[model samples]
Target chain A: MPDHPFLLEAKGLSRHFGNNIAVNDVSFSIKQGEVLGFLGPNGAGKSTTMKMLSGNLAPDKGQILINGIDLLDKPAEAKACIGYLPETPPLYKEQTVSEFLRFCAKLNNIPKKQRITAVDNAIERCGLSDVSQRLIGHLSKGFQQRVGIAQAIIHEPAVVILDEPTSGLDPIQIREIRQLIREIANQHSVILSTHILPEVDMLCDRVQIISEGQLLFIDTIETLHEYMQSSALLLRFDTEISVQQLNAIDHILQSERLADNTYRVTFAPQHDPTQAILSKSLVEQWQLTMLMPEKHSMEDVFMKILREER
Target chain B: MLTISQNELQRLFLSPLAWIILALSQLLLAYLFLTHMDYFNALQGKMSAIPGAPGVTELIAMPLLSNTGMICLLITPLLTMRTIAEERRNENLPLLISAPISIYKIVIGKFIGTLSFFLCLIVMTLLMVMSITLGSSLDWLQVLSGTLGLVLLVASFSVIGIYLSSLFKQPTVAAISSFALLFLLWIIDWASTNAAEFTLLSWLSLLRHFQPMVQGQMNSQDVAYFLIIIFAFLLLTIRRLDRERLD
Candidate 1:
């Protein structure tokens, strides 16, 4: 509504429960059509932040602007532009999927005439067309989660915030939900909070890493991939190589023998020693069975970021 | 607000609890109505010997309406306990919380939803009263005044039930506390020795104000009392939910 590039922006948000600070001075923004993955561990304040952003929980201090409207000042108007799904899908298990979504459409103040189409669109988008007439209690957990998503997007707000949308689903369901989220990102900006790290890489255009209520990292997924690009190499030789021989290469930080004739070689980020190692191995007659740069799994980068924060 | 009220009412009917409460209350009240009618018919000759004797309206309808108050106090908690507490327990509250609506609208919507269901029960009781008009000449003013008193009494009880429901997460706990509080309010005036005193406790008693209207007397003070009680408790419920969001 205003002249802002970000559809949703949270600034210096903080919430406290007694002596515990649940979310501490966090700030970030997401542009339209971008999926901002919120990565965090349990109790890292991801849910708390999501609650504050969606206007469900008011922060002790901070401002949340949805489409440049202040959330605390004009909550109903600002919240009209935002959609939220908490950690547990907030649903009435007694109602059928279409019925629940129609109720949501009413809650969001959609015009009566358009409500049917809005509900139908949400049902179709969430892959819930098959079971729209079934009671939510009778559906599987996966279907219920889809109903949660449907209720969130029923009014087609500018921002859709889903907290742990895929936490308890099986692999197949998880993949299906991810695909659905990817489809949602085509029209609305999405802020998805999940502890699962790979989900961020798979669906997010940008990522924010939070740990202990602190924003440790906020960057594009490419930069996160850069973090995953470890400066380590794995090598296997026909004959066992001495640690001293591996250390002799320039820019090699450290080297460790993992098994017979196998070594994990750490090197500096600016200098890769693969070419040096190959020439040296040839001169020393160390028959190279394998040579490849070691890549850090998402878990490694996640843990490394968390460890550095501590 | 209408949207929330409609959804809440639909959800209430969807559960077996609402239908059970409706059927059980009608059964008990109908039985009470028949017994009172039989007693009035048996005493008809003895009452005619006395000058200006009470008729079916005085003998049957007033007492039946008074007893309806007691039934309402007992059953309203059961009906209203699930209004907010179950939503909180099942984590369904966030859907309402995150919507683009004020907390006041939500509280009032829940109150209206529960009040509408109770209105149906009162209507059923009025139907029973209307049946007596077929056999004898009935005092329409007395019956109407009694119905007004019953409506006000049930309305206040519903407000209390909804307020307690918002305060607790477990529906059973909410139901129990609501019954305890309503019963205390219902009989609090008994502690007063004389009606002439008109102490604060008696003024606050729910039954004290409801009694005059049941006797075919309509006073502005009695109606104001019930209205004030409903407003105050609804305000308390709105405040509770606002505080819950901050918490």
Candidate 2:
């Protein structure tokens, strides 16, 4: 973890509805000005966790600290620093976009003199100025989602928690919203929950994967990639080389032919297969063009972690 | 609280449901008044033949108040059915729940908005009272008392409707349940033969207490009964909203 102060901390948080546990003993922390991607499949307790953090659903088992304040013990103080947008945008259909934001500002206790300016700032930030006067029911899904973000940030809280912020948007809208999230993250710590793997890879600095109410991993995306690294070497040769000749190298555990004259070889991590191949090539008077190590993608790491947990 | 009230009032007026209710109630009230005028004219012609007959004006006001009270019972469910039920149905309750405003303020704000519309309907019916005064020696005091009683009775029914609205998640279910509950209360009073032993039911019956007021007698006990019913149901609504949010 960086030296930055932690903005959010959860310890042994759990929620049970009757006999079934919705979120079981999940714990993680996010730091100041950090973007933490909360990754989980459907019904995997992502929304339940977000709800608890936002004060919408109280936890049945442990403690959540927002800016070092316990949420359960001092709910208003804790919530004063957090903003939340649930999976479904809770909007009054009859209310115009501007009207809704104004009400949210009042609900958030924005000072009377600053309420209009704050609402205007949010409208511009969320790109909702065009449809500000339109009734929420008349707007499309994308515009409605923008309105949701507008309400969440109208209060200018310290942390913004969004559950599936880009769930239903098209590619263009997704990109726009991602940019908006990035911009918002500049000023507030964002806890974004999403099922899209690529979104986490593209936007979040760190990710927490939760499955069946259990937190499987919490690490930076870079470390997660390193954790999934495979012990393989990719080689490209200008001249043709027989598979049998490449197999002659002692460190070559397995070899697969690629296009033209290239080959990929898998070996043990400490083996340094490139030196072995180069020495064999020098001995055989054959040319070796390129030799490089292969790195794993986040998708590979995610699948590997999930598979291991299962 | 003021913002919540203004927002609620704006939403209440913007919907077609509110207008549909007001227009239908006004039409019903006009029909009842025209019918009452005709009946009173016929009764006045026969007043000399009947021994110690009450004046047509006095006879007309009681049924008019009863009819108007019954009409309010029908109209209130329509007014309040969507107040809380539609919010939950559309998943919009969180907007109010997460706000700093208390549940009581939200419920009361909505109640006041609906009551204002109901008051407009009462004002429209005052035209009928004006017509009665132009043709006959009608007691203006009786008219004021009757209108006051009708307003209180309508306000009480609106409270019950709002309370029931908060209990159900679907607008249709809320509307149907409120109508059924109010209809049952109306029938219980209609079927009871003894008014003394059923005094509790009489007090509960909005029509029962409204009768003396429509006849120009302002009974403090009756006024207190209506106020109690209003307070009871509004409190129940607040509690219901709180319980839902907690769960």
Candidate 3:
């Protein structure tokens, strides 16, 4: 198992409801110790894909292998290695956190002797130890989400699939859950589906952008960062300069003056206008006081990809 | 499957609805048991004057068993309404569906969990029926046959409730639908009294099949009818759950 490269592998997954395709020919894999961010807009089939991978819903066409066991052919064995938390946490509110976790441990087929240990471990990992004895319905939304996570990891499944785990929580709860997810990534491959772009940036080692039931992009976070790098620079001159003076710089594709001395300049992707602008500013006595690259936000990268895919 | 059933039982006990229903039904049945015993006591001397009269088994135990069967029909839908429907409504079914167990196990586990509660009710009724042994000589064979009939009838009821519960997301809807279906099957024999072609319907009536066994007949045909009902509904529930995953 250590020699195997992928802990979870899904191939050509496709699912359709009546005439509408929810997921179409999507394939991806996650290696051990890797956190995969499933990014998409609403109704982009991220949840549907998660359902297929977790064995909750069957794919019309595909194969999912968890720890090298075929999921469709041998579901119970394969599912033993997968932990899933759907969009809404599947929780029985009548039970306390410990009781619910114990049930999950049993459902995962953990040995009866080890069930208590498993439940305790999950509670500790998800930061639910303090509330373990509290009723799930009485807990806050954040605590309920934590209980959801606790159940998913109770058996230490190799692949943990969580769909929007941090949705509908305050900032502190989101931070705490994100930290817990980071801890989980140390031992298990995590597939986190969320529309929150920053969540993906902060937690995922790799990213997959899905749209319209198709995977539009798949690569490391570094590649996604590369897409976030825009070919634009913000320059603030101490002296008020004319438009013609600002137009003298080389590699400047477009230029716009916001105030009397502020100029926003666009350049080609491979061109570096910073050195050219500095020299030009000195020669023209533009008295350049500020020069900074305009970085595209994660939202920009996400929207751009989605737009291009369309 | 055992884990799922245990969890289901735990859930059932956690809700106040189950406890309230359990307490009320038991109280009502106990009241009925006392009333039946009192009537039997009042008629005991008068019955001894007859040549061949019905004893405690026929006079008290069979009626109690039959009434318990009727109570089972009335209460089982409420008990089983949340078995699968609440899971769907609360969106907790994914927890089971995503687990390593098969759908067959989930359906069977829910059936067993809910049926076990009904079994408790039967046990309570039997205890009441067995109380007759302290004061009067009871016909043990007749009591055994009647208890068997009650168990089979309740099992059929529970499985149908489980099946109906699987079909809807709202527990109330599941309960109402199950009650309607059970009531229809319970009284289908009433129609056969007036129509000749309705004999088949009478044979399908759950009440008709239950009556012979409670009378100590123990006919294979009656037993098979209950067994077939239980088996068919269970299979349908399993199929519905499997189709749920597919859909």
Judging by TM-score against the true structure, name the best candidate. Answer: 3
lDDT of 3 at A250: 88
Candidate 2: segments with Cα more than 4 A from true spot: A1-6, A67-78, A236-238, A247-253, A258-262, A267-297, B45-65, B127-140, B245-247
Poorest stretch of ten by lDDT in candidate 2 chain A:
A1-10
On residues B1-247, what C-alpha lDDT tens digit does candidate 2 reach at each position?
6666667777877888777877887788778777877877777777878887876457676567678788878877877887888878887776666554566888988888778887877777776666666667777787788888889888888898999999988888898899888877766677667876555566567667877888888999989988998999999999887665335
For candidate 2, the docking band is acceptable
Q: Write the per-residue lDDT of candidate 2 for residues A1-310, one digit (tens) a residue.
A: 2243678999999988777788999989988888999998898999989988877777878899888888777766777778888888999888899988998998777999999999999999999989999999999888899899989888888789999999988998899889999999998899999999889887888999998889998989887766767898888887788888788788888888987878989987777777778887888777778888887766777788999888
**Cα TM-score per model:** 0.95, 0.88, 0.96
Question: lDDT by residue for model 3 over A55-153, one digit each (tens)?
Answer: 888999989989999998998999999899999999999999999898898898899899988988999888888999999999999999989988888
- Model 3 error, position B133 (Å): 2.7
The DockQ scores of all candidates, in the order shown, are 0.83, 0.46, 0.85
lDDT of 1 at B157: 94
Best by lDDT: 1
> Which residue runs does candidate 1 get wrong by more than 4 Å?
A238-254, A275-288, B195-197
Q: What is the TM-score of chain B alone in each candidate?
A: 0.96, 0.90, 0.96
Top DockQ hit: 3
| C-alpha RMSD of each candidate structure in angstroms | 2.0, 3.7, 1.9
Provide candidate 1's TM-score on chain A: 0.93
- On the 0 to 100 scale, the lDDT of residue A96 in model 2 is 92
Which lDDT tens digits does candidate 1 get at residues A1-310? Answer: 5778989888999999999999999999999789999999899999999999888888999899999999999999998998899989999989999899999999999999999999999999998989999999999999999999988888889999999999899999999999999999999999999999999999999999998899999999999999999899999999966999899889898999999889999988999899999899889999999998898999999999888878
DockQ of 2: 0.46
- The C-alpha interface RMSD of every prediction is 0.8, 2.3, 0.8
Task: Tell me how far candidate 2 lies from the true structure as C-alpha RMSD in angstroms.
Answer: 3.7
